[model samples]
Target: MVDLRRARTTPTDRPSDASGKGTRDYRHSWIVRGHWRNQYYRSRGDHRPIWIADHLAGPGDKPLIGGERVNVLRR
Candidate 1:
């Protein structure tokens, strides 16, 4: 998995997946490891969550984000 804990800087574009899939987010999440927690901001009864990518059967199979793969295509 990508190391988002090192995401002290905001990224304008996302990095490529091992399969070449690209991630998208106006605002990206941090902490690729550690707690598997994400950083999100909410406003006026609305909520927006930042996300990360993890392989289900891969080494990091915690699935804390579950199904919310690409923040854009995720629901």
Candidate 2:
């Protein structure tokens, strides 16, 4: 289970460059054992509290999303 959250130290800058991954790279990421959710909050250099996912790894009967795919990322 990959969980993505907004980075506390970096702010999204939409007007600076053409590449869109600036926000993605700085954003916090976590992989644990259910569902993926997106959210944001105000921060001032502090550790964000993370919760353990109960159903992180998808059910064995189906192929998991984002399990394996080449990510053509740009800097």
Candidate 3:
């Protein structure tokens, strides 16, 4: 038996402006947290499960609602 424990990961901080006021743009936008996934690939005429690295999604902008945050987890 294998103990498939998921690693805990958090979204990296958004980039800040020159004034150091944090990442707050006029346009409403938000950053999607990065996460891991299991993908299947063909290897030697067989399918193998591969672990994909985490990747950030969406533009780095403030959320539409105030104090909104997004968290993603492996499925």
The candidate scoring highest on lDDT is: 3
Every candidate's lDDT: 0.47, 0.48, 0.55
* Cand. 2 TM to true fold: 0.19
In candidate 3, clashing pairs total 0
Which portions of model 2 miss their true places by more than 4 Å? 1-42, 58-75
Inter-residue clash pairs, candidate 1? none
What is the Å distance of residue 41 in model 2 from its true position?
A: 6.5
What CA RMSD would you report for each candidate? 15.3, 14.6, 16.1
lDDT of 2 by residue, 21-63 (tens): 4433222333354444443446745555555465534345554
Clashing pairs in 2: 33-56, 34-55, 34-56
Q: Candidate 3 — what's its lDDT?
A: 0.55
| Least well predicted 10-residue stretch by lDDT in candidate 2 | 22-31
- Best-first order by TM-score: 3, 2, 1
TM per candidate: 0.16, 0.19, 0.25
Assess the local accuracy of residue 38 in candidate 2 as a C-alpha lDDT between 0 and 100: 43
Root-mean-square deviation of Cα positions for candidate 3 versus the true structure, in angstroms: 16.1
Q: Which sections of candidate 1 miss by over 4 Å?
A: 1-13, 26-75
